[model samples]
Target: MNEVLIITGACGVGKTATARVWAKAKQGVAIETDYFTEWIYDDSLERFTREEEKLVANLSLVTAKEYLAQKMPVAIEGVWSPYGLSLLHSGLKKKAKNAKLKFVWLYCEISENHRRDELRVSENQMKQRVDIVSQQLQSYHWENYVHHIDTTYLTLPETLAAIESK
Candidate 1:
């Protein structure tokens, strides 16, 4: 069946990498919402606000729907909130009801997250608590569609296996 993989997490959690691999495997497109978010990023804010999420989700919904309409699987990686997913999920379902919707929420130890952040280019460096956003997400009650992945020590291939096997 055609699928839409929503790969979400905080900085340094490997969402982008995993989504890319997954998309390639399925011969699909990987939509990274970071591009959309970056366009409106204000240094004053800590992370994305609800209004920002709405804008990002709206555009992402349109993109995902377009790919799914072509009967291609899609993987979307982003730092998304549960509320944003609720909106995107509904919007996607309305347009592509038969597609399997899978949510992959990647997480890691704070220290590990920091270590990964250190490896990133200076332009993409984390300026604040990677833990805060990720932790806040962990606190929420995730539904059945969501899959939690603890990537404390896993390599990229191992991480890919974990996601695909699930």
Candidate 2:
């Protein structure tokens, strides 16, 4: 059966790298929502807005549906909240009855998150938006569809193993 893995978390939680690695290993498609934003807006991430984010998310879902329609596994990486994930899950279920849907929420301590953000190329923007990240952290609500992974001290391989085990 085909599968759609939605890798979601806060900004610096390594969703992009993890999803890319997982997709590569599984020979599947890795859909990074940021690329959609870049393509549609032709601007930097700092200029991204809520409307643009929603558009990118919807486009990612569409891309995932297309891949599942072709019987391929797809991994989507983004900063998706519970509501957004529910929509993607429902949409995928309606699009492909037999396809498996998995939601992985990667997390780390606030300090670790800040450290990672600092090392990022977009650190300036990330620093300026710390409040937004804090809000995202506080707003996340878990449900049965989600598998949470705390990656504070784990290496990439270890984190991958944990996800696989889940």
Candidate 3:
């Protein structure tokens, strides 16, 4: 059976990079929600609203299901809220009923987040997003069903190991 993996985190938390490597390792496909959001926003908006996030979540989950139905393992990366994740979890199970579904939220220290954001390419760099997303994640109450990984001190491989274990 195929698998649906949701690799989520605040901006600059390496969600996209991790999903790419994970997809390669598992011989699956990786979908980045940012690209979808970019398209919806016409690539002009620096940040998206909650309503927009909901749209992106639905769109990405539907896309993931399409791939999973074909026996292709899928990894979707984004910054989704608890409500959004809950919906995605259910949506992924639709087409791939027998597939394994997992959600991993990667996070790091505020300073580390800032540093990482700066290290990213100028075009994709997100300065305020790092802090804004981090704060939102902290204030929100996430469901215990999801795996929360603090990647402040972990390397990419180590982070991947933790996610796999979860």
Most lDDT-accurate candidate: 1
Tally clashing residue pairs in candidate 3. Answer: 0
Summarize candidate 2's per-residue lDDT along 18-94 as a digit string, tens digits.
98888888889899886665454322324345576666667887898888777778999877767667777777778
Model 1 spans > 4 angstroms off: none
Q: Write the per-residue lDDT of candidate 3 for residues 1-166, one digit (tens) a residue.
A: 7877897788877798889989999888999887876565433434466788778888887888788767788999988888778878777767567888888889899999999889979987877767777887888788887899999998889988998998
**Residue-pair clashes per candidate:** 0, 0, 0
> Where is model 1 poorest over a 10-residue stretch in terms of lDDT?
39-48
Clashing pairs in 2: none
lDDT of 1 by residue, 58-81 (tens): 999999888987888999899888
TM-score of 2: 0.83
Better of 1 and 3 by lDDT: 1
Output the number of the TM-score-best candidate: 1
What are the models' TM-scores? 0.91, 0.83, 0.90
lDDT of each: 0.85, 0.77, 0.82
